[model samples]
Target: MATPQWSKFFPDFYIERLWDKCIKCRRCVSECSYEAHIWDSKKKTLLEDHSKCVGCHRCEAFCPTKALIIKRHPSDFREHALWTPWFIKNIYKQADQGGVLLTSTGCALPYKNYFDHLVLDACQVTNPPIDPLREPMELRTYIGPKPESLEIEEVNGKFRLKKKLPPLIRVEAPILFAAMSYGAISLHVHQGLARAARDLGILYNTGEGGLHASLYEYGPNTIVQCASGRFGLHVDYLNAGVAIEIKIGQGAKPGIGGHLPGEKVTEEISKTRMIPVGSDALSPAPHHDIYSIEDLRGLIFALKEATEYKKLVFVKIAAVHNVAAIASGIVRAGADAVVIDGLKGGTGAAPTMFRDNIGIPIELAISAVDKRLRAEGIRHRTSIIASGGIRCSADVVKAIALGADAVYIGTAALIAVGCTMCQRCFTGKCPWGIATNNPELMKRLPPEVAYEKIYNLVKGWTHEIKEMLGAMGINSIESLKGNRDKLRAVGLTKEEMEILEVKHAGE
Candidate 1:
């Protein structure tokens, strides 16, 4: 293809000097999308346009040319550091904020070995192992309230309904997509998640920003989130979903307000959120209506009433130091499920310090919260959904074994498409457009292709999870939940082992 006229305006320009290695194959020109090279038949010269090069290094990677060398344009960052006001101010601000700056997305932080520190147990020679392929492997799970005990009453040769609570919501699999706000991502990304969830028979959460009109068709698969901002929340919003999540705190930016800068608050985002255009959409640190657990119960009941008690209510809280106690309070606050987010969760944008530090890890938090709830005998009453830094099928299995009824994935879902975790999503300049709000960039992610990628990733993970469960001599996920008895902690302190309630191997 011929180089387009617009290539002249490219900011960076560099020449590749291929002296002895130029085979005159013309492969570089043929392979490059930018059309930066042209064959000069008369002079036997390969004319190149340095300006049009995108620096993708496609030619360099393929080039047999030990002779070709590409160098920078030399003006990358000549400006003095002290002159950049924004950089200086942020540096000082981060210095003042002692909290590990939290962020959302996949695990952007350095990987820790907490998950490896704990090990899953399988039946040895004493017990026979179940063959997952030949025998049945049950991964079916329910996400709502479970009856304390089913009571039967004989009435005229028929059983009467004696259970006072609602029926449990069953899912074939225990994995679900966590809420990623409509405004944070484009409509296509939301649709991709919605469609993928529907295909997989799992749930997808709508962040506090509210549901887009286009996604209303996939309502059954969606769990609408109601956070402090109350964006796009209404009676209809409440009624139009499988479940409602009350977002108390996000693992990414816990204890800090979320600010959708004026630049991203375009007309559509503004309308969906019921906020003014070009205004900063801020989510306060605390829900004004919920000052206490009793007050939280009031909000929960209000939503239940608005939804006619047809949907499950979930209270999502960041995994803090005292999260176990907080989770107990949430269960008492009338939540059908508790969604816990750990420190490694992703965010659209967060201060540097907050992203690096803040909150407890999901592994520790899940173990603690599960222990607390089980001790109180409320574990089975309300489901537990753990999120933040769930990178693969192993993490999901570990989480379920640790006590989570289900696992919520955020960043992993994005990675299935094209997110590089460049950590520049807040700037709205994502090259792949998965996290940006810009129309032109957003168009890069076609709904059909994006959905397929997400579906494939989830499907792959599901199969892997089944394999892991099968290897452990387990047939069902329910048998795995809070089955810490099957797990042993290695290289942990006495206090850590005590808190985790796991004994050393051979003990």
Candidate 2:
């Protein structure tokens, strides 16, 4: 196949060099590989190609006097209220490539985070605040089926709980690193994430990319994804992980397959993914074996039997319009847990249209799922793990209150390890070295350094969660889960407040 014709219609950005501060060091000229800067031999000065600049700020980072500045290129096109500049640029991109305009990172649309509208109730005169330092404020979370209530049975004249609960993974905090494949990010990044998961006693998802041989030691801390491609899937791989996640969809690109371009399919990635080198590895849009709830049940039970039912089986789906109904079906399908990826979820690469336009926000999805499950009396039958746009401790706390058993951290975790969210992951030339495969680029990130950063990030978030719980006079995260009474919605419509199951502020 011939390469699709494509070129930038306009210079997206330009570099501003403060000539007064420039010491003629030529660092900008030497650092930019796109040839954005060139020496004008005739005039003994530097010239910049605005079109070549991607606004990565690589040159700005290394400038001694901070003389270099990167800014959006001034546009001459008359601004249209409806047809924005970005919208116009995307039209040109597709017109050139004759393909979807792919991008990386989470949605960049101006969608309001419903999490910001919900306020947590705190202790006042009637209720006194419990200092976490003096109280046992617990953040430990377990993801899996939970018995609604304990049923006592007499065994050998001793009363014991008769319920045989399904398997669950315990973590020190409610934060779990979301799925990110080795092919999507660098091997060093995977190692760093795995190390942090191990240290934190939390899980890191292996995102449809088969487990690398080196990460086998961290198997107990892994959640291996069995995507439609069935990449690197085998009994041994299933046994290696603490849990198996049957991926139905991702939030970024719903109703579509995963795309890892051939350029990212290096020798090691090919080996791990069980795909040929230099071949695109795409996960089929739909799981051919699963079309209905029964089909889903079959896959879930099959996985349970394969691991001898030792590991919890999870189903991950993008949060769509009928997410509550979908989650209901998943719980009834015998999944131990359901992971919902909201509209703002991050991805290695996705079409711009789908990333911004599809799926429901995680905040709404979590509340809807929780309300639906509770109404059906199945909320405790399976755990709800919410992902997509979960950035900080407050987000985590709010997610639990909205009915998520635990929260998945992706972009925030990446940011903790030095991701700038430049949204050029598909290019495989990440400036911070977190998302690229090039050896030199990967060298910019060290597993040891990344491990510490991630560990510290989660550590700080965990502390903040405890502080929030203490301020609320709640000593445990369990008390916060699905506790809509403790939350009040502000600056939201009455319908929105009703759907969220939270009272309006000052009500």
Candidate 3:
């Protein structure tokens, strides 16, 4: 007998089809981009290939009769501490492919979630909590440099500023849509994010991918990025957005660059990214012109000069060790804002090793950077936008208390728009259509539908943030920024507490 393919024998997901409930509509067969379901005319029944399923649940969701149940496969190896099933399977996969393992989304390791270990303080007897319903709560946030002091001249009781203020980008909330490249995700998803950001009175980053011409009208709410590749960068593109970001590194793969396969580079993406339609888009690990902090400063000023100092310039870096020091340098180098992406940050595709092992959690990084900037008295010189693993309204509240001026949401936004996080984004076959470029799959998510869902998501989160702020006896988000006193640690060590600058829960 021929040896069996063990990988096929050990399927990750099992599709349970209820023959009684199934009406032969074959919707699941058509809906599944993974081709896990097959119709056998000779047998006059639908057949399943369990090995093909990536567990996206598209087939289950689209099944007209609700007959499909995608469940974890009922198979396991002997439990071992060091030799886990995933590790063993990965080794097997490598033996077959002999290539780097690739994965999508964020880190999935079972690391300690510091956000869960921290609790927010609420007003009691000493300070009564404000009622958000009865009173106004300020959630509006301003990004960019703030003047050290304001000098005023009183002219007939009318005050005017003595010096011109630096440019500032204002948002209705302390929430922003994270950077996601155009080719990495479908244009429909991009349009949805743009529309949602515009309607929500917030900003959405146009990742390393260049902005599409159709999105120029939403420039006021967009943060255009200039990565190492410098793709599609031009004079007009430089001035197209309210702010420009210099992407030094990504939290998903900090030390490496980016690669968009030639197959994904459609005409639209090619035009936007300024690369050939059938050519791979490769970004260098570092900007050739920027070898040091001083080099970074030159590029920062060059961008400012290119934009005539009209746009706010930001510098983004992964949350690595001494991130606070790096952020300090970025601010000194003339960045109006510094964005820090942490370990839990998501990506379209990344090597499995970097995604799991690199970078620190955003919670600690935010706190450390905040403490460092405040101590140096340059906190006012730049705004800090925290990202990577911000999940819900509670996470947002905790992040602000930990000292993030604002937070960016990527995976959460996608989840709002029907993403199941199957981690198949790199395959260009996202069944839900959120991360795919396939024409048929892209139709799954209409931009208008995505817009409504994302809009509702932000609106809901904003309401919850207001409630949290009111409970803390705070009427404005500004008060919550860098307010470590409003947070207390739970089940954390003294070392962790010192790093986070929070007291134990009881204390």
Candidate 4:
């Protein structure tokens, strides 16, 4: 195969530098992880190679003098309805590379987002809205099974319940930091998530990557994951967190497993993952032991046994067709919580086809699962924790109203800490330092700094959630769970509204 000449290739981004404002500080060159800006010693100035730019905008943000301007390339092929630029470019790149096209973060395809079509209701005459600032509002949530019926007995003057309650994981807010594992992101980022989760009184999932020894101190707020790969898994590791999440499938690549290239597996990551350094960590498509619901139930009990019944066990599955039925089975299998990850979920790396094509939206999945469980009289058996492309406080509120006990924020959390979503995480060259392990790149985002950013983001979102709850005349987040009447659909079809369990806007 003949290599395409540089002149024939199309560059996605074009860089413009204002030389008069440029201080010759060489900061852009140092800041760009892609090495797009090169110092031409002979020319005595900086020269940019646009082809190397992934459009992360790190250079533009770091330019001290505001001398850099990054924008889309002006050139383009003739436009066609069928052959859009995106498709044409994708084909060109694939034909050149002759391999699977990989991308990072959530699906970029323009699918109808159900959250946008749904609107919330506010109290007015009969049910007056409460002022969150003046009155108390509850966002605290518990994740685990609730007793079918509490047995009570009256003794003397005081009445007391008879049966003991099951173990539950409590959080100050219904928002959780989703799983982004080690070897996939820098340790500094992990530390930041852990510290923030602790301070905010919530939980952060330690993706499929095994728990790092340093983060063990934050175990109370951590949820360690056990994926098919079983990287860095052990007795102590299992007990290191408040809950254990069995990652059956993630939304980003529903039917596929995970692949962390050997190059990103450093010594520290190797130790944490219990994999040899410089070896690719691949999780099999399915857990060899869990081919049936009975097999899944066995593993759930095995983990409970491993933890001595001290920690809650969660089963996470991608939101796909018949998701409600799958969730029902998982609940009956004795999982304390069921995590439903939607199609828009983010990932460090995934085949472009799978990320864009697999899984259903979390909104519909949450509603379906909640309805199925309620119909089966097992709704209280497991908490529904929704994940995938959840953005902003409104999405969180909408998710709860759709039936999620809580929601997980993955991409949004990284964005809070300077991830530009350049789709370069798989390359291990994240310019903002959120996804890279390179020493220099890692220094760009210190744990303390990332922690502060994450803390502020979640705090702001929590405040907004409270305001929304108050507006709905509901003081507790629990009241919003599966309260579909609080929401109304706009452009959604009858089927969509039915699945979401929400009424039409006028009705």
* Superior candidate under lDDT, 1 versus 4: 4
Instruction: Supply the global lDDT for candidate 2.
Output: 0.89
Worst 10-residue lDDT window for candidate 2 reads 2-11
Model 4: how far is 316 from its true place, Å? 0.5
Worst 10 residues of 4 by lDDT: 1-10
The residue-by-residue lDDT of candidate 3 on 156-203, one tens digit each, is: 999999998888999999999999998898888889999999999999
Global CA lDDT of candidate 3, please?
0.92
Candidate 2 Cα outliers beyond 4 Å, as residue runs: 1-9, 23-46, 153-159
TM-score per candidate: 0.81, 0.94, 0.98, 0.98
What's the best-to-worst order under TM-score?
4, 3, 2, 1
lDDT of 4 by residue, 153-224 (tens): 889977898977998888999999998998788999999999999999999999998988899999999999
Taking every candidate in turn, the Cα RMSD to the unseen true structure, in Å, is 7.6, 2.7, 1.4, 1.2
Q: Which tens-of-lDDT digit does each residue in 1-507 have in candidate 1?
A: 754443243335465756678887776665454566777889987887886554545456556665455565543434785654334434444565534443345445565556777887777787777777788888888899887888888899999767676856677789999888988887789989999989988889999898888888888888999988899998888887889999999888778767787888888888888899989888898999989999999999999988888999999999888999999999998999999999888888886666666788898899899999988998877999999988888889888878899999989999888775646567655556677677776777888878999999988988877777777788888888978887888887778777767787667
> Which window of 10 residues has the lowest lDDT sum in candidate 1?
3-12
Candidate 4 TM-score, true structure as reference: 0.98
lDDT for 501 (candidate 3): 96
